[model samples]
Target chain A: MIATKRRLPLPLAALSTGFVLLWVFVAAFPFIWTVWGSFKVEQDFFSRDSWWFAIEGTRTIAQTGSAFTGDGYYGAWVLRDFFSSVVNTVIVTVSVVVVSLTFGTLGGYALARSGYRYTFWLLMLALVFRAMPHITLVSGYLLPFFEMNIWGYMPTAIIVLVAINQPFTLWMLHSFFLSIPKDLDESAMVDGCSRFQAFRLVVIPVMWPGVITTGLFSFLLAYNDFAVTAMLLSQPNQTMVPKIASFLGTIQQEGNVMFAVAAVVSATAPLFVLVLFFQRQIVSGLTAGAVKG
Target chain B: MPHRAFFAFIMPSLVAMLLFIALPIISVAVQSFYVQHERVVTEVETCTPFAGCTKETRVDAEATEKLRNEEPLGRFNGFGTYLDRNHLAVSEIGAILSDNAGFKDAAARIYNLPFYRALAFTLTYTFVVTPFAMLLGFCIALGVDAIPPFYKGPVIFFSLLPMIVTPLVGALIVYWMASSQGILGATLQTLLNDPTLSLKSSAAMTWITLLVYGIWHNAPFSFVVFYAGLQTVPHDTLESAMIDGANRWERIRFVVIPHLMPLATFVGLVQLMDNFRVFEPIVGFSAEANATSLSWSIFNDLRGQVDQLFGSAAATSMLTIVGVIILLSPVLVRTWRDFNRR
Candidate 1:
């Protein structure tokens, strides 16, 4: 195992894959555990009975053997407002996705195309807002907006989401925009298009691949954002990320009753949204401080 | 014609950039000086409408603005709030730099070192996780790249799930897993024969748990990046390498690594920035603080301190940003040029 495989030890590879999956399992556990326990009775959710209670432990010491029927999921749905919550999530996520993509794409194009004096500064500026912990910014601005009586619903969530989205959109799209040769714009202009016209007619269509990737990445970003949305809206139905965090908060009180709904809905909704716009070129729009042209 | 073209082509984006991106940063820099005009020690300086403040004295001035604005910022004396002036105007750039002692300057406090510590920690994290993920992602992509008639479509679907999931959710699961008796801890305790291994320990547990968890949560994104990079790796070189009896290592190191370098470098930088700013996972993950970092300073200034001395937090955040730029100014320039060239 040590000597014969690829450069890294074979055991290391095995351990690496094991560790990766273990990490994934751990990473995925809250959702997975919540989803699993969501199906159990309240008493069963407690330990001494544990995750894999045999038929003896689950049943009433009866003839055959049985676990509780799919009551927990049903409990989550009927009692927890989970369906409504899921619907709210759908609305929030879909709306965020739609909005972030629209504005972020256009903004990215402009930054990519502009001859501004401080391009790096502007890019860094946009990214700074995004990268600075959302809690810090939201904690700062949220109260001000609240006092002005301005921040709420689509306006608040979407605006905050869009602001966060714009940074990545600008940096990522700059790359995508740059990747497309300047010839596309120049040739289109030579054919009698104005600058805007060339961008719209010639550049945009070609930049479509980059545009979709950048925009979709923006959507995913906003779709998962928690800290700002948690602070800004505070309404149960406002943003799913906060709502999931809210559900986690109540775990001590409701335990499995609510977490089941949180785990599945938060976990599944993003996945479903990603698949809807899924593609071959979804190389993350975000890179480390460096990314390739 | 030119005016209309410029307005139509450029105005909205520039305005948006100015309104959202530029204004926020400039405001933060400005707010740092005006912070607690009575309490702060540094002298004031003005530039433009911001009520002039020296850039050096300004910290995460933004956080101060956040706090001051929270309860009616401008209703009093022109809406600016927060500051940390030297007040004394010392001759030799102050005592802290010269004497190498005492916590006199804003930059010398216990909370100040976290940014530097986080820098080293984040850089190590970025360097550690990226190349391995790049390779691992390639292996996964290759496994699915030329899928057989049966396994073709599902492998991509199976493999890319992590990319689709939210990092918050992933971090949450990590919290569960690394909790003292989290499945990982319990399993490891038994395996390693250590009864007293806590996830909150100052040694390996806290940092390693966080990094390992981060790497796990992040690999999918890297996978997608590398997979895309791999798809574009021309076939001829790979085939020619194989034909020339070059070993896999030789081929990957000589042929593949260079080809992957540009993308790898880009991803590496992205990892650096993201990992350094990692707050959510570490914040609520366990009680122990990554206290040495700038984020903790900002958080403490805002969330912990009474009277909401937002000036301190703002200063901390400003310091944090400067630290970020200092760490990556070279990469930032290269990246700027790369985007502009086309």
Candidate 2:
């Protein structure tokens, strides 16, 4: 039902196709280059003599007797103990997704179902909370957490992330709940089920799609977080993004920028897969706010 | 839902936001009024057999620790930290203004102040990136809409990569490619035949690069939203515009854009909020030498080498929050009006 009843003039069509292709190249090239470059030795990937050396892997061949090498990955995942960070990241993201979704769905459902003025105020407050820079919030947390002796623990980071994640999650899930026909729960409520029971019996089963979409975002927030994770989590409890950041500090001097490159690629792999599998949901989730507003 | 049920459902989330989000602002406000405790000192005299006694003053470490332990919030200075050079620099700005220097010189001097410098970059970045990203995304959405359906999915998947990836990693990828030894840097040098033309070599170049990165990072979001909005545009409106002898551009100008206006506002608001908190790119690009943001300045304070400047960080946080409120007030007022209308 696009307004393509009349074809674009030839020149305009060509120009648009060219523009789209150019955008595709711009969007995709860096990752493609970086991923390919990550497998090569530093000398080749960052070849001073010729860019072709990156593709040919000349230095890599010379150093490791192959056109490709896993040295960067090995150095990062093993020698630098990036594995522990991966474990930490898994723990953080999972816990954040679970806890935030639990709280978000409950709050979002209430906000969607209620016909009160204060609900609007609550959401407005959330909008303000959402706008608070994560670093600003971290600044507030640091002194108190340090004083409470909860400064450098995984649980503290997890809880802080849940709170930080709450605003956006609530907004998304609130909109999602609005899209769900309220009568589904209201009818169940009229049949003698309590609100919570109606929510569990009727809404919970159909809520998974929205829940999963919100969970993807929550997972992303926890996984991609640098400010809170970098500051709040102590060295051993550091997540992947912070660990990658920490890698840049220690490894650059050792001429192991490739380790950082490799880690970046590793860090991005899951997100790539997430988009691959959940592109539609991701798109819907993004447009859900804009379209509704 | 009744009030009790609604409260019960929202209580956990409310408690979390209140404890973590609302209370922190108050804590930051309180902390901003206080500076770290001054080290206690004592005058000491020691006498030996061979020499006359010499009086010495030493930092009383035990006393200082005891004082700090007794009051971890430090001593209240009541806005002193806010006015200090590292923060708002009220006195410094006043001195610069009173100097009667030419506008350029005075402007340069004020820009050299850390807080003003960060604020300038942050605002410049937000204002510059938002519109460009929206425009670029609109173009891409138009292009995608014009493309054949067969390729849309893959094209979208590729497009989403930049936005969906971690911000720090995305910035790192761009930074790596733009670094001196990286491919893009080398190609640009070879193309321009100016070996010294490096993106990181100057402040202007770094700012331009960051603006470009910002556009790149943000455009996909707007593209996705706009594309979705495009799909929902009414066919009848376009047909009627065509029947009215409107050209393709006219149809788009009159029909498509109007349909997408609200979505554009949404994108603009979200982008403003996100761009105002530009921190990751600075860290990822290691651009601290040339550029910083309000968020980055706060991070720098907390990560100070000697000791964490809690008071200074809190002051900056409060100021940043104020800036957010200023930036968001118009939108808030409009939304309130809309809600009231509803």
Residue A221's lDDT within candidate 1 is 72
DockQ for the candidates, in order: 0.21, 0.83
The ten-residue window of minimal lDDT in model 1 chain B covers B80-89
Q: Judging by TM-score against the true structure, name the best candidate.
A: 2
Q: Which docking band does candidate 1 fall into?
A: incorrect
Worst 10 residues of 2 chain A by lDDT: A1-10
> What's the TM-score of each model vs. the native?
0.71, 0.98
RMSD of each: 10.0, 1.4
Task: Give the TM-score (0 to 1) of chain B in model 1.
Answer: 0.69
Model 1 lDDT tens row, B1-342: 243443454354555545544554554554444454332234345566665545445444566556555543223322222222221123323444566555455344422443445444555555666656555665554333333335434444445555566656666655654554444555666678876777766546777776676666566666666656665676678768768988756866788668877877666666666666665565546433542334544554555423545445554556566656665777767657866795
